[model samples]
Target chain A: MTGTAEPIVMDLKRAPNVHAATQAKGEALRAALAAQRTGTGLAAEQLDALPVPHRRVERWKHTPVAGFWSTPEAPSVQTIEAAGSEACPVPGLHAYRMVFVNGTFDAKASDLPVHNGVRCEPISMSDADAGSQGPLESTDWFAALNQAFATEGMKLHVAKGVILDRPLLVHHHTSGENNANFMRHDIHIEANAQVELIHWSTASDSSTGMVNIMTHMSVESGAVVALDKVQDEAGSLQHLAFEQINQAQSSQVRVHTGTIQGNWVRNDLNFRLNGEGCETVLNGFFLPKGKEFVDNHTTVDHRAAHCNSSEQYQGILYGTSSGVFNGKVFVRPHAQQTNAYQQNGNILVTDKATINAKPELEIYADDVKCSHGCTIGQFDEEALFYARSRGIGEKEAKAMLVHAFIGDVLEGFAVAEVRMEVEHRLAIKHGWDTWNDTLESA
Target chain B: MVNIKELQASIGETPILKGLNLEIKPGEVHAIMGPNGSGKSTLASVLAGREDYEVTGGAVDFEGQDLLEMDATERARSGLFLAFQYPVEIPGVSNINFMRAAVNGKREHDGLEPIKGKDFLNLVKEKASLVELDGRLRNRSVNEGFSGGEKKRNEIFQMAMLEPRFAVLDETDSGLDIDALRIVANGVNAMRSPDRSFLVITHYQRLLDYIVPDFVHVLVDGKIVLSGDKDLALKLEEKGYDWIKEDVIA
Candidate 1:
C-alpha cells in the first residue's frame, strides 16, 4: 500500500464515459493532492486497491452513481470566506459554532470554547493515524475517496460525567461552482457524559458541486448522545454521507437525519451495539422534488444481549423524483432477548414519482423479537376526504395529512430546537403558510 | 332548510337513490329508517356530496342555494355537516388540532378572522363536556385506538364544535351503548336551535327515543315508500321492516 510521491495527473480530454469516471476522478484527485503537497496518509496503491461501487453491487443497486462520478471535478480547497453565524439555516442554534467552507476550516467565523472536559479541534491527516478505524478498511468507494481528499474536519471529545449545557453546531457550507468538498468528523462521548451535536450543511449559491462527508461516533457506557444532521444543498449538486456509530453498555444514542432539498443524495448509516443494555434510535425524513433522487441505506447490528433499536424512515416524493430505502436489522446468535423494529413508509404525490422500499430482519437468537415493515402508498383518500369535509381546503388538507403521515418521525427528535427547525423546513417544502406561521409562533 | 326534489343518483351503473324527494324545515328533526340496501345511507352520502354517488338527475337546494353544484368542502363551508357512521382513523393528527382547523376553516369562509387560541381552547372544553368526552382524547390522534363508544361521542363533540346549520347523522347509533347513546342524544338535543335542523338516518328506533323526530319516512328500494308522523317510526319498529318491504313490493 505504498507508492512514490509523484503526482498522478488526470486527462481532461477523456471521453465522458461514466464507467471510467471513478478511475478518472481518482487519478485527478491524486494529482490535486500532490500539487497542494498536503499528504493525506493514503497512498495511490491503497486508493487503487479499493473497489468502486457499480450497478452490480448490492448496496448501490438502486442508486446509480454514473452521473455523480462523471461530473467535472473541482479543486478541493478554495479561498472563499465563511459566512457568519447569522447565515445559518437554523437560527439561534449557534451557541457553539464550528464553520467550514469548501472543506477548509474557518476559525474567524467559529467559536471554539474551552469548556471543562470538552475539546473541539480540527483533525489533520497526521491525527487521522491515531484513530482506531481508517478508511482503507472500509469497502465503500466514497469512504476511500473521502480519506484520500479530506483536509478539514473536527474531532470533538466530552470527558466522563461532564454534560455540555449547549449544543455544538457544525456548519458545512459549500461555495464556488464545481467544487468537490470532502470532510470527516469524529465525536467521542466518554462514560456517563451527555451532549447534543447538530451538523447543518447548505450551499451559499446555486452551483453544480459535490460534497462527501463521513462521521464516526462512539458513546461510552451510561452516556447519552443525540446527533442531528440536516442537508439542504443546491438542486444542481450531489451529496454522499457515511456515518458509523458504536454504543457501549447502558448507553443511549439517537441520530436524526433530515434531507429537505438536494439533487442527488445518498446516506449510509450503520450502528453497532457492542455492549449489553444499549438503546439506539434512528429517524429520517427525506423530501425530493423535480428530478432529484434520494436513497437511504441503514443497518443496525445487535452484537450484545438485551439491546434495543428502532428505526423509522419516511419519504415524501413529488414531481418526477424517486427515492429508495433499505433498512436491515441483524441479531447475532448471542444477542438474546434483543428487540429491533424497523419501518419505512413513503408517499408518492404524483403518479410519475417512484419509491422502492425494503426492510429486512436477520435474527439468529431464539429469544429475540425483531420485525420489519415497508409500505409504498399514496395519500389516504378517506383521510383526505375526511379533512376536506371539515371545510379545510384541498391544499391545506393535503398538507395536514402529509404532516400527519411523517409526524411520528419528527416527534421522535429528542432535541426541541432541532425538531422545530425540521418542522419549519417541512412547512416550507409543503407550502403550508399557516402551518409555518404556527411553527414560528410556537 | 334543505329541499330535495326528484333526486336520482347511482354508484357506477347501479342506481341507489331513485327519484327520491324530501323536505326538511328549520327547527325540525326528520328520521329516515330503512332495511339494509334501501338507499338510506345513499341519501346521506348524496346530500353530503360524496363523489362516489353520481347524481344522474337531481336538484338539491339548501338555504335557497343549489347544493348539488357545490363540492363536499363547499357544502361543508356552507354549513352542511355529516357525522359519519364510521369516522376515519387518522394517525398522528390530534383531535383538538383537527377541530381547530375545521373551526378556523369555517370562520375563514365566513370572512371572519381566525379564532383566538384561548377562545378555541375554551370552546373545546365546553363542547367536549357536553358529550362527556375524556380530556385525554383531545390530545390523542384522531379516532386512533378509540373505542366504539368513544368514536361515537367524538362525532357529536365535533358536531358541537363546528356548529353547522344542518347536520346529517348517518347511522350514528350503529355502534353505541346505552350510556353512549344517551350522551350522544343529549349532545344533539343541546345543540338544537330555532334556525338549525337535523336529518337522522338510523336502523333502529332506540336513538329516536331520547331525541324524538318531528316526522318519519320509510325508504325502500331507493325511494320513500311510506311517510308519516313520529308514530310511523314506532309502528315500523314494532312490526319490523319486513311489513314495509312487502307493502312496497306488493
Candidate 2:
C-alpha cells in the first residue's frame, strides 16, 4: 500500500503539459485531503498512487482532463425536498425509484419498498465487507477517487430465476456551485434472472458542479440485462461516468446511452465476455450544442470462443460544440468464431462544430470476423431537395433528416416511453417547430 | 397555366436550355420530344426551382405568378409538381409520412387546418390505388428497395395525393414495361380536369398512345424547332431525331 506524503510532487514528464488545469486540481485535492478525516475503504493514500490522466494516455487522448478536473473547490452539502414524478421525463412508466443528492442517498425522496427475490440497500464505506474489494481494487485514477470518497450508493442483488417486473430508476441530482460528488453502485444478477435499469443525472440548480460515478455489473449464466442511461445536466456542470460489465456463459446484455445536454461529459464503458455463447449490444446517441463537449469511449473484450458483439454510436453537433467517439474490440487467440462490428456516424449542423471519431479492432484468432466503419459529413443535399420539393420547409426538412439519421439508435430502446422522451428532447434542442407542434397535439 | 419565354439557363459554364419557349393552357396536355441532349430535363428542373441551374435570360409564369422568384417548397405549395426521372431514395423516411407532409404543407400554406390522422390515411389508400402501389411499400421508406417500375409508380401516387395544378412528367415512362406504363398513364389521365394540365416529356412516342397529348414539339440544340399536333410525334418516332437536326441545319 502506498502512503501519503507531506509535500507531493507530480511527475510532469508523464503528465501532458497541456493539462495544467488538472495539475492544479491535483494540488487542491491533496490540500483538501490533508485537512479531512480518512475513511474505511481505499484511503486517500491509495488514490495518491494513481496518476491523473493526460493526453498521452490512449483512452484520454482526444478528451483531455483540463477544465474538468482542475480548479477544484471544497465540497458543499445540500438538502433537497422530494420531487414529484414530473421531474422524471418519462412519466407514467412504472419503476423503483432511488434518489441521491450530492452523492448521499436521500431515503425520504426514494421509493424502496421490499420485494420478492431481490434486495436493495445503500452501503457506506464502513459497512462494505471484504467481498466488495473486486471493484475497488482498480488502479484507475477515477475509480480510486470514487472508492476513496464515495459516501453512499445503491447495492442490488437479484436471486436465481427472478425476473424484475418493473425497471430500476436511479436519479442523481446535484445542487450548489463548486460541489464535487463521488458515487459507486454494484449490481449482481444471478443465473436465469432478468432485470432492466434506467439511470439519469441532472442538476437541480444552474451551478458549476462535478460528479464522478462508477458502476460494476455482473451477469451470471443464462441471465439477461438491459441498461439505459440518460445524462441531461446543466451547462455549468461536469460529469464523468465509468461502467464495468462482466458476462457469464450464454448471458445477454444490452446498453443504450443518450447524452442530450451537458457542458463537459465523458463515459467510459468496458465489457468483458468471459463465457462462450455470450451476446452483447451497445448503442449511443449524443447531441451537443453551444460550447458543450461530450465524449464516449467503449471497449469490448472477447476472451472466450463463440461470442458476438455489435456497437453503433451517432452524434449531432451544433454551434461550436465538440464531440468524440473511440470504440475498440479485442478478440483473444483462443476466441475463435467471434463476430464483432462497430460503426460511428456524425452530422455537423454548423461549420464551426467538430467531431473526432476512431474505430479500432484487434483480432488474434484467424477464424474471427471483425469490421468497423466511420462517417463524418454534413446533411445530404439531394435528400434535402427531395423533401423541399414535397412542400416541406427547409428547417423541417433538416430536422426530418436528422431524426432519420438517428432512427436506428432510437429504435434500439426497448422502452417506448424512453424513446418518446428522447425524441421530444431532440426536437426541443433542434428548434423544430413542426415536431414541437406534433408533440403538443399528441 | 404555364408560359416559358426565351428560357436560357446553364449549369455551371455549359448552357443547357437556350432560348427555349413553350406555353400550355388549362385543360391541355402537351408533349416535348427530342434527342438525348436537347435540354428536356433542364426545362423541368428550371421550372421546379432547382438552384443548380442559373437562369441567364428567361421568365416562367405559373398562373401569371413569377415562378423564378419562388423557392422549391413554395413552388410545390403553389400547385407545381415535377415527377423526377430518377427519384431519390430516403432510407428512414416512410412513404406515407412523406405524402402526408406534402399534402399538409400545401394545405397549411393555403391557411387550411391539417388533415386528421384517419382522414389522411384514407387519402393515402385512395391515391395509392391509382398507381397500383402496394400497401406494404407505402409503409416502407421512401423509394428504398423499390423496383424501377415501383419507383415510377410511387412518383405518380405522390402526384395524385398532392393534386397539383400543373405537372411535368420528366421521362415517367423511361424504365417502365408495357403493363407498368399503362398503369402510370391511366393514373395521369384519371387526374386530368379543366383546372389542371400536364407536360409529358419522353424520347419514345409509345406513351403518347396512352395519354394522347394535344400538341407535340420537337426540341433540338436547346431550342424547340417544330410545333404541331399529336400526329407530329408519330411522324418523328417513325423518322428519328437525326432528320430533325438535318432539317434545322439546312
Candidate 3:
C-alpha cells in the first residue's frame, strides 16, 4: 500500500473510426446545401477535416458525443400555425413571438410586428454564411455542423437609442423520430438600445432527435441586453447549443441559462469584453435526474481595462445522473483593474450521482482581482433535520432545500413569465407543488 | 403530560443519559439544573426524537403514546417542540413559510385543512410581535444572518406559532442578554396553559427567575440527585453545584 502508484495511460491511437452512417449523413447534408446553392463560407472539405466531438478531447472527456454522429437522423417538417399553438409553452407571455417548427420560421404562427425600430427577419443563407468565419472555420465541430446544415434562424437588429416595449421570444419546436435540425440567430443591439430576449426550445418525448444551435450577439456602447434561454427538451433528445457574446465600452449584458429538462445536453456560452468599463453577469442552473447527463461550459475573456465579469453556475444531480460545469476566466496583460469572479456549486442528491466541476482563472495582469471556486456537496444534514423537526416531511423538505439551493440563480431570469414557467416545471419535476408558494418570496 | 422512567440513551458507544428519570404533569413547569456534560441537552434531543442519540434502554410516554417510537417529523406533529440551543440557519427557508408548513402539518395530522393565507399572515404578525421579532425578519430566511439574541427571540416566535403541547427549552437562555432573555421568557410564559407542559433545562438559575418553574431538580452524573421547589435553584446558584456533587456522592 505504501508503494508508488502507477500512472494510467490512454492510447490516443485508438481513435473512433468514422462510421459509414455518419459519412452518409454528411454527404446528404452537402447535397442539400448544394441544391439550395447557399454558400456557408466554409468548404465541405474543411468540415470533413475535423472529426466529430468525442470523449478523446480534453473538454469532451466527461461527455461522449462519438455516437451522436453515427446515429441516423432525418429533418423534422412539423409546423405551428396559430397564436395559441401547442408548440409555444409560455402562452400568456406578452411578447412578440417568433415560432420556428422543425428549424423553419413559420410567419403565420409568429406574432412579430416590427414596430419599434426593431427589425425581425429570417436568416437568409447569405446571412448565415457571413457569420460562419471565425470558429466555424476552425476546430469547433458543433459550430461547423450548425453552419453546414442550418435550415433556419432569425436575425434581430435593434436600432440605436431604441428601447423595445416588449420582449422577443424565439421558440423552437421539434417532433419526429430520429429528427435532426440546426439553427442560428444573430442579435445586434445598437448603441444605447435596450431589449429582453428569450430563446426557448422543446421536443417530444418519444423522438430520439438532435438539435445544434449557434447564436451571435453584440451589445454596443451604453446598451443593455438581457437574455433568458431555456432548453426543456425530451429525455431522448440530444441538445448542443453555443452562444457567443461581445460587449463594447460601458455596455451591460446579463444572460441566464436554464437547462431545466434534458437528457444529453451541452451548452457552450462564451463572452468577450472587448472595450473598457463593460459588465457581464452570467448565471446558469441545471437539474438532471434519472441517468441524464448535462454539461455547461462557459468562458469570459477580459481583453480591456476596467471590465468586470461574474459567473455563477450550479447544478443538482439526482439518481444515477451526472453533470459537468467548466468555467474559465482570462485576464489579459493590458486588462488591469479587471474583476472576474466565477463559482460552480453542485449537489448530488443520490450516492450514485456524479458531478465534475472545474473553475479556472488564467490571469496575466499583475493588478487584477480574479477568483474562482467550486463546491460539491450534498444537502446539509443539520438544515434538513431542522426542517424535518419542524414537521416538513422528508420529500417536501428536500424540495425546499433544492429550491433554496437554486433560488438566486432562478432570480437571474429577466422576464417574470419565463421565471415562473421554469419554476413551474421544476415544481412538477420534484413534486414541489405543495410547497410552490414557498418559492414566491425566494 | 410527559413521563420518563429510567430513560437511558447514548451517542454512539458513549452513554449520556444513564438511568435518568423524570415526570411532568399538565400545566407544570419543571426546571432541571445541572453542570455541563450532565446530559441536559441529551435529554432535550432524546425527547425531540433526534436520531443522533440512540435509546439504549427506557421508555418515554407523551400524551399516552410512546414518544421514542416516532420519528422527528411525527414527534413534531404530535405536539413536541425543541427550541435548539444553536438553531441552524436555513439560508432560503423563510420564517413565515416554515411556520406555515409546520402549522399546516400538525393541522393535517388532525384531519383539518391547511390554514388560509389571510389567517396565516395574521398569525405571523401576532406571533412575531410576542418576541419582538421584526416583520422583516419573518420574511427573511430562517435564522440566516440573525444575531445571537435575534436567533433566540426567533425561536420563541416559532414556539408561539407552533403552540406545542409539550415544549423543551434546551438552554434557550445560553446566549441572551437581560432584555432578550426577558422577552423570550415572556413569550414562553404567555403560552403556558392548563393543557400544556414545559421542561426547562438551564445551566444557571437566571432564566428560572423569569419563567419560574414549579419544580426544581438537580441533575448530576446523568441522574437526578435532588428535587425541591424554586428555592433549590437559588441555593444551587448561590453555592454552585459543588455542594450538590458532594451530597450526591455521599
- Candidate 2 local accuracy as lDDT? 0.82
**All candidates: DockQ:** 0.49, 0.49, 0.50
Ranking by lDDT: 3, 2, 1
Q: Model 1: per-residue lDDT, tens digit, B136-238?
A: 8887888999999899899999999999999999999988999889999999999999999999999999999988999999999888888998889899889
Ten residues in a row with the worst lDDT in model 2 chain A? A1-10
**How many backbone collisions does model 2 have?**
0
Clashes of each: 0, 0, 0
Q: Tell me which of candidates 1 and 2 scores higher on TM-score.
A: 2
Docking class of 1: acceptable
Q: Which stretches of candidate 1 lie over 4 Å from their true place?
A: A1-43, A71-86, A124-137, A436-442, B241-250
lDDT, candidate 3, B136-165, per-residue tens: 898889899999999999988888888899
- In candidate 2, residue B106 scores what lDDT? 97
Clash pairs detected, candidate 2: none
lDDT of 2 by residue, A1-442 (tens): 0232111122322544445567567657645644563434565676765567666656667775666544445545443463322334466767887888777777766776367998877765335662364635344676677777765678888999899888888888776676668888888999999988888887754557578888889899999999888887764777889888889999999999999788889898888898999999999999899998999988888888999999999999999999999887878888899999899999998999989898877777889889899999998888888888888888988877877788888888867777777777778777886542232122
Off by over 4 Å in 3: A1-45, A49-51, A80-85, A124-138, A435-442, B238-250
